[model samples]
Target: MSKDFYTQFILPYAGIIIKICRAYTDSEEDFQDYYQEVCLQLWKSRENFKGDSKWSTWVYRISLNVSLSLLKKDKKVNKKSVELPNLDAGAPQDPNPFNDESLKLLYLAIKELSELDRAIILLYLEENSYQEIAEIMGLSPNNIGVKITRIKKKLKTLLDGKIY
Candidate 1:
């Protein structure tokens, strides 16, 4: 792929890509694989984009699809544990929400959700409007709202009702 495409398209959306990939993968190695695959898919599908949706929406759909696909593939193979470097190890201390213990617990709870539910909750946490989520997820706006409510309840239960 051209450096120009990487700089112009992927760079701006790196955060979205990272968050989607991280939410889907359990370990650093898997995370790296998923991220690279999503980028490759984005590059390959660029020519097929037909002005049907906002560019960010396209990114979200592609990222989610790639993550889900890779996750299923990984499950088919027997996985071995690999220790990874601390993700926050050389980073400056900031008030990032991921640094919060409660948020960590929330993420743990999220992992217990079904794959489709994980995508819905991830998009919801990103503050995507119900309609936008519906558009990206190929669901009705009302269905998105209902799913979000159920996912929240599931998270609350998974967290023992401590950090809803």
Candidate 2:
């Protein structure tokens, strides 16, 4: 991919990277650091990107790979607890942004989900088509659709406090 292609096509999706990082990290700093790492890894892998896939699909592949690899490293280093250093010990928590408390709760519930579920949720939440999500995740489009359906129900239940 050319630099302009990266900037134009890939940069606008940076929020998705932030969401992925936040899903993987418990603390804000670690989230930022991991997001930066994902950006670097994505840039490094630019040449490996082929035109067979959408840019978003390519980014999803790269970001998920980096996040999962980092998660594995984290597991190896901190087997019991994944606590990050406390940088904002006294900072007040910010209110969730979505007007729909359910949506906000959904994002909170997403953080509790496994890494695989997080990727599914991230793409679905971004309004990616089932085919695009399937392409990025290497799942059949039908399977991706079903999983997304199940996950959405799971999110609603969690948001409604039907299940913790």
Candidate 3:
């Protein structure tokens, strides 16, 4: 992507991209790799964007797709579970926005979800309307509602220690 485009569009949406990368990755290194890959993919796919939806929505779609592809590739090669770092057991405090312990655990729980469920919950967390999520995910609006309910229940179970 051009510097102007990155500054004007992608940089503004970098927070969303980082959140998606963090949700899918298990380590700081992996997170950085995923974030870089997402940016590269977004730049490469810019021509495919038809303005059918909002720019942020398109960025979300690209970020999730790139993350999922990397995740699947890693699983096929390693077949080993990668533990995410416990931010609660950190070395020092800083001004990082994603440093809350509760939010860390929440993301850990989200990591346990199925790929599609993870995407759904992330979009929900972003405050996307059901219709908008449906459009981005290519699901019916009613289906998005039903899935969100189920995903919430699953997340609650995960948080409650009933399931992980």
Candidate 4:
């Protein structure tokens, strides 16, 4: 990717990509791999973008799909311990709601969700409307609503330590 494109297009949206990656990855190494692969795939698939949706939405779809694919491959190859790194290492210390300790716990809880539910909750947290999430995930808006409700309950249970 050209510097101009990287600066103008990818960098502006890198945070969203990173958040999606972090949601799916257990370790910083895996997160870096997913982030790089997502950037490469974004460039490779740029031609397929037909202005049907906002560019960020397209990026979100690609990032989520790439992370889930890598995760599935990892699971098939290694059924033992996944060996996730310390979650705090290398994480930005910036004082944002998403970076706070409670939110970090929320992310750890999110990581326990099934891949599709992880993607859905990440999109919802990003403030995407249910219609937009449905469009991205190829599900009906009503289905997205129902899934969001269930996912929220799941997250609550996970955070409350009610679920093993």
Between candidates 2 and 3, which one is better according to lDDT?
3
Give the candidate order by descending TM-score.
1, 4, 3, 2
Better of 1 and 4 by TM-score: 1
lDDT of 1 at 120: 95
Model 1, 1-164: lDDT tens digits are: 89899888888887788778767777767777787888899999999999899889999999999998888888788563444314553222223637767877887788789999999999998899999999999999999999999998888788995664
Error of 1 at 84 (Å): 7.8
Candidate 4: which stretches are off by over 4 Å?
79-99, 161-164
Candidate 2 C-alpha lDDT tens digits along 1-164: 46685577556876676566666777656666677777788788777887898776777787788888988897888843345424343222233333555554566688777788889988888889888888889899999989988888877767675334
Clashes of each: 0, 0, 0, 0
Runs with alpha carbons beyond 4 Å of true place in candidate 3 = 79-95, 161-164
- What is each predicted model's overall lDDT from 0 to 1? 0.82, 0.72, 0.82, 0.82
Candidate 3 or 2, higher TM-score: 3
TM-score, one value per model? 0.88, 0.77, 0.87, 0.87
What lDDT score goes with residue 118 in model 4?
92
Q: Candidate 1: what lDDT?
A: 0.82
The count of backbone overlaps in candidate 1 is 0
Model 3 misses residue 92 by how many Å?
A: 19
- lDDT tens digits by residue: candidate 3, 1-164: 68888788778888788778878888866777787888888899988999988999999999989999999998889844477643343222224645666676788889889999999999999899999899878899999999999999988988885334
Instruction: Please provide, for model 4 over 46-148, each residue's C-alpha lDDT reduced to its tens digit, 9 standing for 90 to 100.
Output: 8999999999989999998898898889889983345553545443322353545677788879888998999999999989999999999999999999999
